[model samples]
Target: MSFQDEFNSGVLEVISPSPAYYPDTSRLRITLGDPPERVRWRSKQNLDFAYLMMYSQPKAVFYDQLDDILAKPHFITTMKIAAYDRIANKQSRFVLDFCQLGFIGKMFRCVELPWLVQLFFMFYSDKPVDRLLENEIHTKVSLLATDDAACRRAKDELWVHYKPSLFQHIGTQPSLKEKLKKSGNAEHPSDRFYNTTVEVLLKIVPLSEASENMTSDGYVIIGKFDSRCIAEGVVSQKLGAFSELRLTVHSVSDNRAILSEIFIWGQEAR
Candidate 1:
């Protein structure tokens, strides 16, 4: 069978079921989390701003926080016609907002994601990225553990070593007029690009508070396009931010035949 045929047959897992509220649609409520030590700062050359980079260890992986999952990777996609509901039903909204408080992952239990939507994640990122997920990108998902303290330590060291310049102490620098003008125009192209991507994602997704829970907290965002494609576009649009960008579809159950979950991750440099 063709890849498409395989996808339609039993290859892809569905995370939601059809219903009138979503009418001819399916959804999976996605939840995300980070470890307390996974958050850190990075610098972009042009903007004179520090971009926050969230990290993870091999055993200490980030999760979508969905409940009763079979613990395996699932294949999925976001066709052009896919759309997400703006008004999550009252019941669904409650599920999305409350998934984190339950210590679902910390205590090794699953919590209900909105159940009206699907979830996805990033399983791996090669140091030197060659390409990114776009239309029809394929991937699998899996579970990770936090038992390897050594892996976590290695990740911490690597993060500190290659983190982008934070323009540390910029607040102490004088904001001279001419200097400001030169500095504004002198901003790095890469930094500008990076800022743009974050801004776009913020506008499109339900981003967490800028100053809130740097680690141990995350956001669930709904956009009109296939998440995998959007993620790939962002990665390609800001290719220099990292050496690689990839994703996995953990659970998908949309009836619209157009949508899928797209999870993102920040990786260590090779």
Candidate 2:
């Protein structure tokens, strides 16, 4: 069978039947539980933003917060589409936001993201990057647990990283400008990024000469994984800011695909 045939047949796992709300609503009075307390910030990044946001809130209230989001359609489907944006348009933030809301690899799982979506999210973020990258283009921080320059740069980038596409405001976003303009970063936060770094989960598959072997569907044997396994990855550079440059890794057999996702952060990063 063709790679496409195999891909459509199994490897990919769906998020189950679907994520939909009942179209019909009936009034039913019920006793309520204890009131929810305010959630305090655990860290500067609040990596557990989803969990903390939902943990303290009552179940009804927790889901209610996502009413605007859930009311539209099954988030799984929406995120799946968003995953494509990340791949097709290099919209890394969209994919990351999906993971943020869906909690891709978190322990205190809140929502479920389809397996393929998770892969695409990571693949795009894990663009191959040069360790010696400077400061101009999108740069990646090493996931090391030491106070070092590279790690510091990485953490700072993660802290300052922002994407305007995620917002729908009407005017200039002064708040974002302010966030981007801040200084005073630690000389070194740590050293050595993690294997689980969200944008660093790349699997490199080298091909001999794919043009000759590849099928019309653009499918190629990729280390037993599909080409659409994840989003395109960070690029190799001397030193740069975050980028939206999409790297096409499925052209020739010799060409390799670089994929990444937010599989690691917070405690896992340590």
Candidate 3:
């Protein structure tokens, strides 16, 4: 099976290549071994559209709006009650079916948004889950994203679209002002379009040291010489010595020197 990779902080995580992978929920979880000795954080944008779509991704929280209001009983017990009986009739699917169960299990595996979408349950739920007291809780939920919800922020009011589970998870509507007070570091897929990658710095140092370091990191340096004639002589002397290595030039006072090093291979995990 194919795999996908994500760079988070100093570590790299690889997961299932499923297209459904998102920051909140994923199908598989695996780390790409241990942290590399050194890593350069490259600003790459592969999922900018998805990241841009989110207004304020709320932290996964435990919020039960119907804590004392609705009794926590069996999955269908609340459905049979007077408050949910009407909802049951409208929704014939009593218990979760196999497909629903699979997706629900996936959600459970992620452990973020549960079965309830208290306010905007429609976004996350195919059919209302009265069993979770979310059907009626819709009336109490103030957070909303209309059918024609726009991605743009609303003036004088913060706006969110598509993710109603945020309201149910946060227990209350989020304050955009509060969210903006903090900074965001996650890279979006569209970020590459506007990303300005400039030459941060330039260093003129000894080539042997730099080449040695690269070699230690699994880079195959074929030759390190001061001039083309000397590089040819060194290679001619050891015909097949650096055949498997990638040829490189490191000149110093007309002298040739070659250093070998080890390095880890591959980026991220699959």
For every candidate, C-alpha RMSD to the true structure in Å: 25.0, 22.5, 23.1
lDDT of 3 by residue, 1-270 (tens): 423333544233333334443333222122233122111110001122113212112432211112111122352332224224434556322122111110121111112233332222233222213222323223223345343233111211221111111111111232222211111112221211111111111123234433433344444333332312222112222222222334443322332222221122222311
- Candidate 2 lDDT over 106-213, as tens digits, reads 121123222222332232122211111122112334435255666655554332222222322122333223221111122222211211112221133223434433
Worst 10 residues of 1 by lDDT: 41-50
Model 1, stretches more than 4 Å misplaced?
Answer: 4-10, 14-19, 23-270
lDDT winner, 1 or 2 = 2
> Could you tell me how far off, in angstroms, the CA of residue 254 lies in candidate 3 after the best superposition?
45
TM match of model 1 to true structure = 0.14
TM-score each candidate. Answer: 0.14, 0.18, 0.16
**Model 2 ranges off by over 4 Å:** 1-36, 39-82, 85-95, 98-149, 152-162, 165-270
Q: What is the Cα-based TM-score of model 2? A: 0.18
Our tally of clashes for model 3 stands at: 10
- Writing each residue's lDDT as its tens digit, candidate 1 over 236-262 gives 222233323222233443321211222
Question: lDDT of all the models against the reference?
Answer: 0.21, 0.27, 0.24
What number of clashing residue pairs does each candidate have, in the order they appear?
15, 39, 10
lDDT of 1: 0.21
